[model samples]
Target: MHFISHLSAVLALAPLLSLASSAGLVERADDASCILTASGGDDGPIFVDAVQRCETVVIPAETTLSIATGMNMTGLNDRNIDLRGTVKFTDNMTYWINNGFYFEFQDQIAFWMLGGNNLRLFGGGAIDGSGQVWYDAFATNDTLLRPILFTVYQASNVVIEDIKMLNGPEWINFVNEGQNILYDRINISAVSTSVNPAKNTDGWDIYRSDNVVILNSNINNGDDCVSLKPNSTNIIASYLYCNGSHGISVGSLGQYAGVYDIVENFTSTNVHMYNAENGARIKAFAGPGVGAGIVKNVSFSYFTEGNVDDPLVIDQCYMTNATECAAYPSNVYIQDVVFTNFYGTSSGNEKSVVASLACSPDGRCSDISVSNIYLEPPATYGNATYTCQNVNITGNAAYLFGDCATT
Candidate 1:
């Protein structure tokens, strides 16, 4: 009780401290009251100076802050970003293509990377990524690399809340090598005006991180709503409404030849999925020259779907020809996965088959349980159909899905 009182008193006195005492406030860049614009060259040196001198930096509302170049924002502490305006990047394709950090794993690029401690970014504002041009260009040119909108790289103890992210060029958000990050009440959407749609616009990709939580968000995008990428553990995603997505998925892993991926201890609950291709899916590539790993202790519960195809699916023979897939089954083992409390309506295309679990013929799946599933086939079609192969059923509450077609 005493410590709480003391901390409160200290916080109350924080605003009274003189700006000259600890650090100064630089609110202008060469004349404007509170606006800072970056000219052509690298913008790192200017931001480094501002962050070092100011404890709280405010980007005023009704202004467009242009970033003409890529930046590397690193090694800062105790800062608050009060973003109330639009931050838009230039559409200089050649400059951006030559710049930004490169990740060879997925041929990914990032415009700017943020890292530090006690960092907070919030406001009723938006960050715009000029995506339409990239969308049209990528339709014809597959080799063009579009950069991610925002990346949290090598940072900890961060909170991002109550913001709007719009029209990202590629993946909207990527969190890599960070822990203790929380995102709440954020809005994300991407739509292309042209015929060429936005491609690979994953809402959130958590890779190589732990202890992350994302709650109460809406995602209308082109790809996975939230993907627990390779090496993502201890993650939680709840209360999500996803549309036009590839569903909340795990592992297009085992694609790379020599790498091992591990995804464990994750949960995604209370999701409303609509107009998607799949729901609650786990896909692994099957081939002799593929990676291997273990996925265990994961659960997807309390989900409701509408007009979705493959409402519940697990295909170990992902993206491989049937003959070759049978010849070389997946080496990655899947164990201890639970899918419960799902009720939904399936699309009319696959009228008879609502759920399919086509595991590896080599029996690489074990202890897979399903219960309380009520997925109805198309209204005019016949009864629901279910297929399960090479999996050990731990328990099924009502056998809602009929007899398993075990091989």
Candidate 2:
């Protein structure tokens, strides 16, 4: 009790000091009286920036704004965020997840965001997501398909930089159907605990999007650190550091069916994976009468894996169907998959070989190649095996291919 009182007294007296002494629960505003500031009201006809308090603001084209939050930013409509000094959300909120986002509803603490566009952050600051409410709510609800950090749709040209997301809800950064998106110089970290320690918390999930670039980011999540899902195409990720999660994945494709399905032109290079599940995987379920999922022109190179589940898993015989246990040839076409300069460790029982390509008998995964691959497992498993009926391997692990000519 005395310590709490003393801390409160110090906080009360601390503001009398210089702004340099500012710390927690501190709020600052942009002042037009000192320098240049956006001029006007919130009628979509004004250029509002450099102010202290605003319920809703319309940032004019080619304008900049800096925001500090006591609660959160709600009702942020379409705006051009050309520049921002800094944006800080409350370390604690009434709810569990204090997401510093433009919510979908008009009320703060709501868990949805609708509009996004041309939002750029220059001068290196942060948009912190204190995902307390999201965490508490998801856990209580036991909702499987929950997203944590960001939820924006139908927006375009989103640029995020120099931010640190300490704890996320489910998926940290979800860029959907937006074009020319870049998440640069970002770090997302969440250490797993025994209870509720980050499950299915993928680092960056891009679905139905194009021309996305994720460069120089570090991720520690519970699921695929970087996942390129169905309808996500023409993507590139480089210089990524992943820890204690599923390394990086291409598909769990055909989850959302359509003629408009496929994730293409994807590349993951210069990656470092440690304490993770399968380093590189292409996962899909098996069923019948579903639309076809065709994946083509994907490449992975220069990666280091640490004891991943299956250094590489092509389980086309996914057990999504219980009754159809013998159901083979899930309509998705897995083709032109290549692995090169890949070095990694494997599982407890068998670590001999580094690649496992398990496909269906009828629609067996074909035209797959692995080159310059090296695996050193922990004495439990030895010499990774290639068991695809219609796949061809032509590298160091190729001589094990006794029936390479027939299929």
Q: In terms of lDDT, which candidate is strongest?
A: 1
TM-score (C-alpha, index-matched) for candidate 2: 0.71
C-alpha-based local distance difference test score of model 1: 0.76
Alpha-carbon runs more than 4 Å astray in model 1: 1-49, 397-407
Per-model TM-score versus the true fold: 0.88, 0.71
Task: Give me the runs in candidate 2 sitting further than 4 Å from their true place.
Answer: 1-117, 122-124, 132-141, 192-194, 256-260, 321-326, 349-353, 380-387, 400-407
Best by TM-score: 1
Backbone clashes (count) for model 2: 17
When summed lDDT is taken over every stretch of 10 residues in candidate 1, the lowest stretch is 1-10
